[model samples]
Target: DLAVLKSKFRGALVGSLLGDCLGAPFEGELVSSGDKIVIQKYFDKLESPDLKGPIRSYTDDTAMMKSVAKTFIDKPEVDYTYMAKLFVKEYFAEPKRGYGESIVEVFSKLRKRKFEDVYKPAQEQFNGSGSFGNGGGMRVAPVALYFYNNYDAMIDVAKKSTQLTHTHSLGVHGAVFQCIAVSQALACNPKKKIDPEQFCNELKQKMKEVEKENDDGLNLKVEQPYVDKINVIQHFLKAKYNDELDEEIGIVLGNNICAIESVPTALYCFLRSLEEIPTVKTDNIFRRTIQYAITLGGDTDTIACMAGGIAGAYLGEEAINRNMAKQCESYEKTIEMADSLYNAVCGASNRA
Candidate 1:
C-alpha cells in the first residue's frame, strides 16, 4: 500500500518542482495577449550565453516543502510546535528564499529570542487578526500523504500547521480543503475511474463541516460561498485564467488566506488537468497548468506549488519533465526522503 503511496509522493514532488521552475521565471509577469511574454523574455535571457543576473531559484515554497518532507522522515507524525520550529529554522538557514514580509517579521521575532511570542506579534502584524496567506496551503501536500489513510488525522494536522503561522480561520480552512483534495486523489481506488466532479463534490461536503466548526478569528459564515457559481467547475476544467493577472486570486476567492483563496485556486488547477491523469507528461500538461497560474500574476509561487501538488499526486513521477526534474537541486534528496518515509510507513503498518 505504501509502495503505491510512495510513487504518488514522488510524483507530487516532481510536479511541485516543475511548477516552481516554470513559474519562477515568470513570477509577477502580466499576461500580454494571453501570453506570458515577460516570462518568455526572462527564459530567453536565462537560456542565453551572456546573461549577467543571478540564477533563478525556487523561493519559500520549495524550502517549506523540504521542511515538511524532513518532518515526515524524522517524526512521521504531525507535531505543530515542531513543524513551526522547523519552518523558522529553514527560513533562517536560507534568508533569500521567497518568504513574505509578514513571515519574515514573524521568523525574525522567533530568531531574536522571542520564539514563544511568534503568534502574539503576528496578530498585531495583520491588524489584530493574523495573516491569511497561502503559505499554509503551499507546504501541506506532505500532510496529505502522511495521512492518506486517515482523513480525521489529516484534518487535525492541517489545522495545527496553519495556526502556527497563519492563525486566521480562512488560512486553516484553506489547508484543510487542499489536503482533502490531494489525499482523496491519492487514496482513490485504482479500479475505479477518477471523476473530478465527484472528487470536488466530496470536498465541498467535508469543507462545509470544517467551516461550520471553525473557531478561529475573522468572523464569517462557516460555509464557503462559491460552490454554486455557474460554470465554475467547467471554468476550472478549461484552465480559464482570470482576465487581470496583476491582482491576487484572493480577491476573487476571498483573500489568500487558507480557505478563500489557496484552496479553491489549487483545486481549480487540479481540475484543469485532472483529465490528463496517469498519462500527462510533466513538460506539457504540468507546464500548461502552472504557466496558466503565472499568467494570473499574484501569488504565483503558491499557486504553482499548490496546484502542482495536486497534479503531482495524480500523475506521480511520470508527469514530471525529465530535464527540469533532474535540475532540481533537491530532486535526489526528495526521492530519498520519500523512500525513507515509505519504509517507515511499511514498518508501522507491519507492526500493526
Candidate 2:
C-alpha cells in the first residue's frame, strides 16, 4: 500500500512533467482531430531505440508547478509571500519559458517594487480587477499534494496562492478546483476500482463546501459558472457521447489557457479517456491519457499537464512510458522533486 501510494505521488508530478514537455511544441498550434493520426505517429516514434536527447521540453506551467512544490517542501506552512517570491524569482531566472503576458506583468511588478506584502501586485492588476487567467491553476498541483490530508487548509491556501497572481473569481476558483481534483487523485487507492459517480460526487461536495462561504469582498463567493462547468463535465461523462464527443466538449468547454475553460477541459479529458485510450492505445495508460488530451489541441501542454496530474495520481509511475519519461528535460530533477514531496507526505502521515 505504501509502495502504491509512493508510486502515485511520483506519478502525479512526473506525469505532469511529461505532459508539459511532450505538449510544449504544440502549445500555440490550432490543431484539429484530423491531426490525431499525426499525433499518434509522433508518439509512436518515442518507442524507437535510436531516439536521442530529450523528446520534448516544458514551459511556464511546469516551471511554476516546481515552485509550488519547492515552496511547500521548504516551508510546509502556507506562507503566501514566500511562495509568491519563488514564482516571481522563477520567471525572472528564465523568461523564455513563455509565461503568459498578464502573469509576466505581475512578476515584473513584484520585481520592480519589492513589497513586504507579496499579494499586492497581483491584487492591483487589471486596474484592481486582477487577472482571471489560468496561471494560478496551471501551477497548483503541489498545493494539493502538500496539503493532501488537510482539505480545509488546502482550499484556503489554494485561494490565497491563486489570488497572489490571479484575483478574479474564476481565476481563484480554477486553482481551487484543480487543487481539489489533484488532492482526490492522490488520496485514491491505485489498486482499487475507481467509482466515477462517487468520484465526481465527492469532489463536487468538496467544491460545494469550498464555495458555500461568505464573500467579504474577496471574490470568494461560491458561484454557479465554474460549478456549472463541473456539472457539464459530469453530464458529458455520464452520457458518454459518440464520435462527436471530443468536438462537442471542445465547443462547450473550450481548451484555452483561462483556468475556467482549460482546467475543466483537462479534467474531462482524463476522466473520459480512462475507459479506453482513444486512437493510439499505448501500453502506458498515463501516456495514452496525455496523448489523448494533446489531440484535443488548443493549449495542449497545459491541458495535458492538468490531465496528466490527475491521471498520474490514478495510474502511478508504472503507467508512464519509460522511454518518454527518460527523454524529458530535467527528468532526474523532476523525479527527485516527486520523491521529496512523497517523502514529505509520508512523514506527515507518520506523524498523524
Candidate 3:
C-alpha cells in the first residue's frame, strides 16, 4: 500500500517533468487562430522528437514547484523567507529559460542584489494594477500538497509565494485557487469524481471574502479573484473548438499570460482527459495529453505541465507508459524529490 502511494507520488512528479520537457521546445509556437482544420492537423502532428534538444530543460514553473516540494520535505515548518530566497536563487541562476518580461524585470533586480526592493513598485507592473500572469499559477501545485490539511494555510502560503514576484491581485488569486483545486482533487473521494462547476463555485466562495478584504484595505476595486478563476473554468467547459487531439482547445485558455486563463484551462484538460480515459480507447493517455497540450500554442510548457500534474493525479504513475515517463533526463532526481515530499506530506498528516 505504501508502495502504491510512493509510486503514485513518483508518477505525479514524473508526469509533470515529462510534459514540461515534451512541450518546452515548443514553448511559443502552439498558437492557432479559428482555423479548426489546421488546428486538428497541428495537434495530430505533434511528435516527441520535436521536443528533443540539448537544452530541453524544465522552465521556472517546474523549478519553483520542485523547490516548494523540497521546502516541505526538509523542514517540519514552512518558512516563507527560505522559500523566497530559493525562488530568487533559481530565477537569477538561470534567467533565460523562458521567463515573462515582467518576471524578467523582477529577476533582473534580484540579480543586481536588490531582492528586497523587487517588490517595491510591484503594483505598477501591470497598468498600475500589477500583473495577472500565469507564472504564479504555473508553479503553485506543490503548495496544494504541502498545505492540503489546512485550506486557510494553503491560501496564505500560496499568496505569499506568488507575492514574492507576482503582486497582482489576479496573479496571486490564480495561484491560490489552482492549489486549492489540486488539494481538493487529491483529497477527494476516488468513488466520487470532482464536479467542475461545484469545484469552481467552492473556490469562489472561499476566496471572495479574503480578496474583498484585501482590496478594501488597499483601496483597489478589483473584482473578486475567484470570479476570474470561475470565468476560466467556465470557458474550459463551454469552449471546445477542436478535437481531443487538436491543439486549439488547449490555447483557448488564452495566451497563458492570464493566470485566470491558463490554470483553469489545465484543470479542464485534466477533467477532459479523466473523462476520456475510460472510453477514449487510447493506451497512451500521457502521449495524447502532451500532443493536445502542444497544439494549443503559446505558453506551451506551462499548459503541458499543468495538464501533466492533473493526469498524474488521476492515473497514478504506473498507468503512464514507462518508456515515455522514464525518458525524462532528470528522472532520478525528480522522483527522489517527489518521494521525499510525499513522505513529508504523509508524516505531517500523521502528526496532525
Estimated TM-score for each candidate: 0.80, 0.92, 0.78
**Tens digits of lDDT, candidate 2, 1-352:** 7788778888888888988999888877877767888888888887666788654778998999898888777775556678878888888899999788888888888877884777888888889888878888888887787777777778888898888789887788888988888888888777676776777778787777665652556675535566678788888888844657877877798888888789988888888776774575676667777898888888889999988999898888888878888878877888889889877776663221
Q: Write the per-residue lDDT of candidate 3 for residues 202-264, one digit (tens) a residue.
A: 767776765675555655575664666566666666554335534444444564668866776
After TM-score superposition, the amount by which residue 199's alpha carbon in candidate 2 deviates from its true location, in angstroms, is: 1.3
Clashing pairs in 2: none
Report how far residue 216 has shifted in candidate 2, in Å: 7.5
Candidate 2 global lDDT: 0.81
* Model 2 misplaced stretches (Cα beyond 4 Å): 53-55, 213-222, 348-352
Evaluate residue 20 in candidate 2 and report its C-alpha lDDT on the 0 to 100 scale: 90
Model 3, global lDDT: 0.65
Span of ten consecutive residues with least summed lDDT in model 1:
274-283
Q: What is the TM-score of candidate 1?
A: 0.80
User: Any residue pairs clashing in model 3, and if so which?
Assistant: 30-297, 31-297, 247-295
Off by over 4 Å in 1: 34-56, 117-124, 189-193, 214-231, 234-259, 275-284, 349-352
Residue 305 error, candidate 3, Å: 1.0
Per-residue CA lDDT of model 1 for 22-106, tens digit only, reads 5665555544543656554543443345545543467788788778767766775555556667888888888887677687877
Clashes of each: 10, 0, 3
